[model samples]
Target chain A: MKLSKLAMVTVAAAMVGGTPALADLVFPSLSYRTGPYAAGGIPFADGYADYFTLLNERDGGINGVEARVLECETGYNTQKGVECYESTKGEGSLLYQPLSTGITYQLIPKATADGIPVHSMGYGRTSAANGKIFSHVFNYPGTYWDAASIIVNHILDENGGDVKGKKIALVYHNSAYGKEPIRTLEELAKKHGYELTLIPVDHPGQEQKSQWLQIRRERPDYVLMWGWGVMNQVAIKEAANIRFPMENFIGVWWSASENDVLPAGEGANGYKAVTFHGVGSDFPVFDDIKKHVVDTGKAAGAGDQIGTVLYNRGLYAAMLAAEAARTAQALHNTKDLTPAQMRDGMEALKIDAARLEELGLPGFGPEINVSCENHGGPGLGAIQQWNASDGTWTLINDFGPADRAVIDPLIMEDSLAFAKENNIPERCN
Target chain B: MSPDFLNFIETVLNGLMTGVMYSLVALGFVLIFKASGIFNFAQGVMALFAALTLVGLQTGQVPFAHLINAVLGTDVHHWGPGLPTVLAILVTMLVMIALAFLIEKVVLKHLVNQEPIILFMATIGLAYFLEGTGDLMWGADVKALDVGLPSGGSFWWEDVTRNWAPAGSDYFGMYIDTLDVSAAIIAVVLVVALTLFSQYTATGRALRAVADDHQAALSVGISLRSIWVIVWSIAGFVALVAGIMWGAKSGVQFSLSLIALKALPVLILGGFTSIPGAIVGGLIIGVGEKLAEAYVGPLVGGAVENWFAYMVALAFLLFRPQGLYGEKIIERI
Candidate 1:
């Protein structure tokens, strides 16, 4: 309590970026480089920063306008994140990538009021998929609901569509980020007739002997984890110790990273996690990144961390943001654009296979389309397995689309409520 | 053995091991409090700093890489090759001792005659300062500390125990990490060494004199300042051991500092000045919480590990406010 966390955040915010640019886009990266989650946060921050660096270094900046990359550390705390938003929102900041569900939920209202978009990207309020009511917030390319649906479907597919009396356990981090998939899982369980076991692990879940003991006792048929950071590593290690079938354990995209599984050693082999994009550094985009940024000695982080799974996800998020800016520039025919204009560009942004190829990232991720009604892009993801011996991941299943039947109505219901509460007109059409 | 009985035994064993880890941290607090009468809230952060320094030294990671890079416009990650494990540990010990001395001289010296609450608040500030300093020194990613400590399941123990267990019992013969076993052994050695050093050594007698009465110790020609420095250094050493155990267990990260909060309830149950009380209190809390999580946790949707220890401390305190082994206070004022 020496310095109020808000005060520290505000001071840290001013330290991020101060130079005003009239002909450039401003995107403040609300980053967490120091926290319990920093192990996961570092790569994402590095990748996000690196992508912007590459854009500026190689392409002479996005749409020929020098882009300003402001990195204000949030330490993964929600209130500090808001303080960061408050401190930096006035510096022509167009969008924010909070990378935390708690922060995203807190900023939804503020960003909506300020007319700047919040890009949560694959995480956050799943109902933010509805662009109409949540016009300023986007989790495009995927959402937590999409991940839940895809994971449940993958489980059903694995069990030959017959989990009539089977037990499925969700060992999730005990937070809004982890609890997000619960309702979706319950709905899927109702459909699949499977018994669901919810085991909540508190934040920074390092001690889980009792939870694992319970799992060993109950012997759930499948263990679906909604874990992040140290929790994922600990859970995987515990599961391996208890001799749980690693194949049957599926984690959300957050749980699938080298940092998460590598610590468990070979015991984590065959562990599976659903991901929305291709993993590894073998993609063509990495070559361009290496040639222009990393090899040119302009990389934002250690060269070794260039293309890890989380790193790639972060890079992809930055690309999407930059693409939105580019799209805005093309449509408006101007280099200087405001946050409002950027919002319009986000609404009309598209990144198809051709565009991915053009960006030197063919087959990197699924094609995504953003619109007024569908802020969440094509919600498709694949399952990847960990070859723990060799320390690499391989996609084990083809892309599976999220169940729109289950998710669309849920989004409609939640977003409509939000719109009503805020006295905003629905813009579904 | 019956499977239920075996499971109970396993839970107790696990709890005791966890309790030992907590006591390892609680011991540092006890040492400093007994000698200096300062409730050091930054003890956990001290452990974190020790571990970070250990890893940074081991890996030859340059201290203040980000700051150095920003200031000098150079992306320097390392100075050269890493040191051997033993050398790095020794260097880390030196760093911690120097830290203890520096803290005593700079921060602790200014507030010697202050009230315990004031000292406690000062320690909180120290905690924040040390935590921020640790992050700034080592850039905040969870670093793996490999002192060649054994990790993963101890299959030999499981294999041997499974031979005696009854057939068809789903008993996996108790899964315990080898790292935890190593830590428990190290902690036992550390406690024994501490006790012997205190009982049979000159510095130990001086520490005891300081603990007894500062003015009496000063009258007896024992430099209270030197004793304070010695005790803080010993506490720093204890924090290093605790840090290594935890950092190895769950990676060297920020949450390692939060483990101090867990040790707080232990200190409550153990009393501030009794080392033995720390051990006993930690075991009680660890066992109580684990068993509660196993039995009572399910009824309440689980996750009782968070508050069960504090609840135990609170319930224990209702009767004996001075704690189990605490010296009774005779107030005349």
Candidate 2:
């Protein structure tokens, strides 16, 4: 053998053999703590990190293995996100939770190629629900398609099971993340007779005067928004400016943060958004987090965003990842897990109501069960309304299923097209 | 009497109002550009930093609290009870003045007699540095700025205008944001004050002379360094006003810096050196973009206002390169 090749082989073997048995399970957080979207990203990054800290402090770790978070700031830019992914993926990274839809879309094929699982949870390409096509990408609990259907269902419920001839407008950000729900919404609009108006707001959406003005002129019965960052704040403010009923205004999960509504003050009262999880710091897990993670000064960022909406999401994502790690440990009969083993555990992961109660997050979110054929959990969501007076988002409805009749077909078509285009064979079969 | 006509008028009125908000930002750019030949790219970042300082001071937030906490392993966030809005604004003005002095000494002083592009590049660096420093000091969280500005629609005007629509027509009323109305009034006061300052005061005359010719102004016994500091301070104060209005409209956040994007087209169409042109150019772009978005946007996929302003600016550049009120660029060939 050549000297260089022999030396490389010896070094590789020794490194593999010398790898420590107690190495921490790595979770790379593609966080954007600086940028226009920092307001939304800060709380989320805090929550994610704090949850891992909680696991370390309160429970020793997930199944006796310490969980370490590798944070790389993306600045909410897609290129920066990809750069973060490349730089962090080599750190024995088990999974990725790219909070941005643009980043998630870019990471899907790349992560799949790298044998790592990406849990885009409630965001990203909705078709990833079809695990047959996208075995590595999981947007469990809910997808944008599910959120759209859930929103339509809530609207339908409000109108006594009918929204015939009613006008509904969608004020969406002009990007892939914003466009994900349009197809599902269109299908639902056809299934149930309703007029749909589409208004696209460009990125950063600092100015939406023209859009709100159009909404006023058209006077849609309900205005559904798919906005993020400052777009949400400006839209809510402009809606209030035009005297639009705050009750009729709804946003996607990304748009439901405190930053979005606090700017408009009392004017944002009664603003509703569809969420897959609970809001506020009422959960028992928060008490544990405060005691073990925050009070000890071992918290993530500031330690002030303990129970905010995005913070809770980050904590929930960590909990899911930790649970998946435990599941992987048990299935493989080993604590040291490979990224592929993590994918296996994620596929077989099941978090029932009892499991949630045991985890001290009772009634916080829908039960999730992952299988080979289903990467996205039972697509369920609830409606949350902002009460500007008390400064809290109250769950206005029970967690319910999305309109599967409309969503299933769309998912099938999109995923099938993606599978064909990428030459990816069905994996579940 | 036609509801469509009323809607058209309403669009124009709202357009004019939105235009005034754009002018608020553009005025700062014109102030700096007229006094010195540098197009201040940091004007938007200055507004963001000023608003952050105002919010931080009002809330009694300890400066660099996050960094301090991170470094010292402490949990300090606020220092004491919040300050009153007026007191906070006054304190914030002083901070902006100090920042102006520092910029003149540190950045502008060193870049004197350099190429205009070099000065512009310096402002870009200044913008990024200010944004990062603001984040490090106050943290990146969004904060609400009240300043007691009345927001939401003017109900009295809406009610009165509602009767103008046909009795049975769908046009409910003309919707105008009270905040936008207040911004227009403030913008007018600002422009008048600036005109009076430059046309009346000794320092203002020195500023105009410097804008006319930096070397000549220096030769005529005007202190160039003092003039730069004075103009930058005035620009900083203008940024504060713009910050208050925009911050009140939308919570003070990092996106406040992106308002510079909204001002770019206005600066292009309204000559780079004319304060009056900033206002007129803002109105033209605002009305034109709003009308296009309202009428032509629906036909095309909508969101045309994003680029419609730039398209108008491009057309203006094609016809009148110096802009409506910009001095004609004369060269001795």
Top lDDT prediction, candidate number? 2
Worst 10 residues of 1 chain B by lDDT: B169-178
TM-scores of all predicted structures: 0.92, 0.96
The residue-by-residue lDDT of candidate 1 on A108-138, one tens digit each, is 9889989899998999888888887788988
lDDT of 1 by residue, B176-251 (tens): 7677788889988988998899899998988988998889999989987778788888988999999998887767
**How would you class the docking of model 2?**
high
TM-score for candidate 1 (chain B): 0.97
- Across A183-246, the per-residue lDDT of candidate 2 in tens digits comes to 8888888889999999999977988888988898889999999998889999999998887899
How much is the lDDT of residue B70 in candidate 2? 83
lDDT of 1 at A424: 82
TM-score of 2: 0.96
Candidate 2's C-alpha runs over 4 A off are A1-20
Candidate 1 TM-score versus the reference:
0.92
- Every candidate's TM-score, chain A alone: 0.93, 0.95
Interface RMSD of 2: 0.9
List each candidate's DockQ score.
Answer: 0.39, 0.83
Model 2 clash number: 0
Q: Each candidate: what lDDT?
A: 0.86, 0.91
